[model samples]
Target: MVDKAVALLANLSTIAEGRLAIAREGGIPLLVEIVESGSRRGKENAASILLQLCLHNSKYCTLVLQEGAVPPLVALSQSGTPRAKEKV
Candidate 1:
């Protein structure tokens, strides 16, 4: 099922990426919680998601940016892996 796939994809590393990839497709709510959850992995994932959302959909991109995810993303962009840097 799509929900299972979605849930399965939502781990510490992938949650942000996955949410950004699927946010407007019904992922924003879930990702919001993760972003505001105060977990390191959650924040990292949320930042990644926000950047990816911006890359594909300017509208949602604005939304993510407005949510204040850019700072953490900027940090991640500096030291994250190649794939991680690419996403942010």
Candidate 2:
């Protein structure tokens, strides 16, 4: 339970150093749920992770769009802090 919660909290995005690895190998549904339902920190982190994946992995970016992530990321860009906007 604790491991699950921690994974949910971070959404496999915290490790920006390994963006492609996480996006390609980890569970997308978990990250999607975090992006959709988590706190500000969570959403921001998810966006950063997505940005990295979107930049580094075409397949992941396609998945990100197919999963309807752009609208929320755009919405976040509008109201989020500068750093957040830059990452997303």
Candidate 3:
């Protein structure tokens, strides 16, 4: 269920409105948490959503950083599934 939701969010984050909505709805911390400890596929999708949120948007990047996403992202980059590493 969580993986499906994260995947949906990943797809949604590709659009401007979805990015804004996710940020406005306080989804950053949740994404960060998922990246930190979710299933492999969940981490991949969550990281993808976060990357989408940060793309060409310093505000969202800062929000992601402020939510303490970096450490988990770094960890994922090193040890997560291949797709997860790509997302990170």
Candidate 4:
């Protein structure tokens, strides 16, 4: 169920409105937590959602960074599943 929700957010995060909405809803920390400890699919989806949330958006990029997303994201980049690493 969490994985599905993460995947939904991942898909929705492709657009600015969805990204901001997700962020405003406190999705960033949740997604980061999932990326750090959720199941394989959940981690992948979370990483994808976060990537979309931060990519090419300076404000959100800074926001996620300030939220301490980088270390776990970097860990995922190194040790996560192939799909999760691909997203990272």
Q: Best TM-score goes to which candidate?
A: 3
Which of candidates 1 and 2 is the stronger one according to TM-score?
A: 2
Supply candidate 1's per-residue lDDT for 29. 52
lDDT of 2 by residue, 7-52 (tens): 4534555455556556557645555666666666666666666776
lDDT of 4 by residue, 26-77 (tens): 8888888898889989999998888887785878778878878889889999
TM-score on alpha carbons, each prediction: 0.48, 0.67, 0.96, 0.91
Flag clash pairs in model 3: none
The residue pairs in collision within model 1 are: none
Model 4 misplaced stretches (Cα beyond 4 Å): none
Ranking by lDDT: 3, 4, 2, 1
The reply for model 2, stretches above 4 Å from the true place, is: 1-17, 24-26
lDDT of 3 by residue, 23-86 (tens): 9999999999999999999999999999898885899999999999999999999999888888
TM-score of 2: 0.67
Residue-wise lDDT of candidate 1 within 1-88, one digit each (tens)? Answer: 4334333544422455554557646555555555454355554555555555566668877676666666656666686656556656
How does model 3 score by TM-score?
0.96
Candidate 1 wrongly placed segments (more than 4 Å): 1-48
Candidate achieving higher lDDT, 1 or 2:
2
In candidate 3, which residue ranges exceed 4 Å CA deviation? none
